[model samples]
Target: MKFTTYLRQGAPRLAVVDGGDLIDLNDADAQVPADMRAALRAGADLQAAGRRAIQAGKRQALDGTKLAPLVPEPGKIICLGLNYYDHAKEGGREKPDYPWFFFRAASSLVAHGEAGWLPRVSSRFDYEAELAVVIGTAVPRHTTQADALGHVFGYACFNDMSVRDYQKRTPQWTIGKNFDRTGGFGPVLVTADELAPGATGLRIQSRLNGQVMQDANTDDMIFSVAETIALLAEVLTLEPGDVIVMGTPAGVGQARTPPVWMKAGDTIEIDIERVGLLSNPIANEAA
Candidate 1:
């Protein structure tokens, strides 16, 4: 089932998407929490409740509501860099034997249709389309790849917008990746059961304004979700609501002949097959 979070009465609320309508899970069943992260922590029982809620016929049209990040305050937002072979090659690097991981602060997140601010300090902002994995169950350290997939709840489209200059300031990418309101995180989260295991072989693409920029298949990733999770779990525990943003593909702006950057009034979109499309508009920081 597809799930999303949206603003209702000025607070974030979880809903189950049914076609173009949204069924407020909390309203339908008081047992279900209003927050997507909390509902996810409740485990599969909440999904069963959500299914019942959808059957109760208490949905509202989705268009009028303001969407929120799928998990508004994910405990951890782990991202992989150079995980795609083609992307590595484009960056003038060889395929990596291990996934390069980084963290994105919660404050950096923005939901679909929201404005992704182009910082006044820099105009070299670029987009990286990625697949975001939302953790469901707590995974213990040393878990095997075979068991890692079970801990995933869902997947969503992610646009890992970067400020290229800040990214190169230091070897670590934290500063460049964590600019406020740069992470495009939602539209909808498709439960793992709804797609192929590990979400492999899906078409992922990025479009700036109306033109396609990055285009590739999830299968091209050198580190699969299960493998990345297992490797990460070996060092740290994976908790529910933690998100893993699998890396982008070959066509990033920095590698282009004439680097393409996102500027005010532009719209950036990341569309992942079977997951959903996440779109954001660009605006000056003051706007």
Candidate 2:
């Protein structure tokens, strides 16, 4: 089942998307937990109960509600970089010996359709269209590839918007990637049972305005989702609701003939086949 968080009277609440409308999970008798983070912490029993209510059609869809980040405020937001051969090559680097990872603070996350602000600190803001895995279980060190996927809850489209200038300032990428409101994710979270975690062959593309900017397939990932998960699990514990942003394919603005950075009024549409489209507009942070 697809899940979403939306705004109602300036408050954020969880809901399940049913067909064209959204069923308010907050209205279910089970007392919709505080948020997705809380729901995940409640464990399988709570999630199962919520799913049953959604399937029973006991919820109501609100009118004129706004979409919030699918899993707003995750416990951790880990990201993979240079995991796409073409992206690595575009950055003038060789194939990585292992998955190169980084972290994005949960505060950086913005909802789909919300304005993604380009910070004035760096003028080289760029876009990265990626597939993000949402963890559903705690994975400890030394997990196998086969067991890696069992920890995933589902997938969603993520835009790892970057400030190339700031990113290259140091060997670490967190500085450039952690800018507030730069990590725009989710129109909805497609559950694992529906899409099968770690399954490749899905197409991912990004558009600036009406023109395609980035286009590729998950099959092109140098380190597949399962591999990345298995590798990360060896070091840190992967808990439910922790997010992993599998790096983007080639075709980013930074690699263009004369690097094309995003500006105010620009609209970025990240579409991942089977998952969904996540679109946001560009705006200056100072504005």
RMSD to the true structure for each prediction, in A, is 1.0, 1.9
Top-lDDT structure, candidate number: 1
Off by over 4 Å in 2: 45-47, 55-64
lDDT of 2 by residue, 23-71 (tens): 6665764565747767776664435655665677554553345777777
Quantify all predictions' global Cα lDDT against the true fold: 0.91, 0.83
Give the distance in Å from residue 277's predicted Cα in candidate 2 to where it truly belongs: 0.3
| True-structure lDDT of candidate 2 | 0.83
Compared to the true structure, candidate 1 yields what TM-score? 0.98
Candidate 2 colliding pairs: none
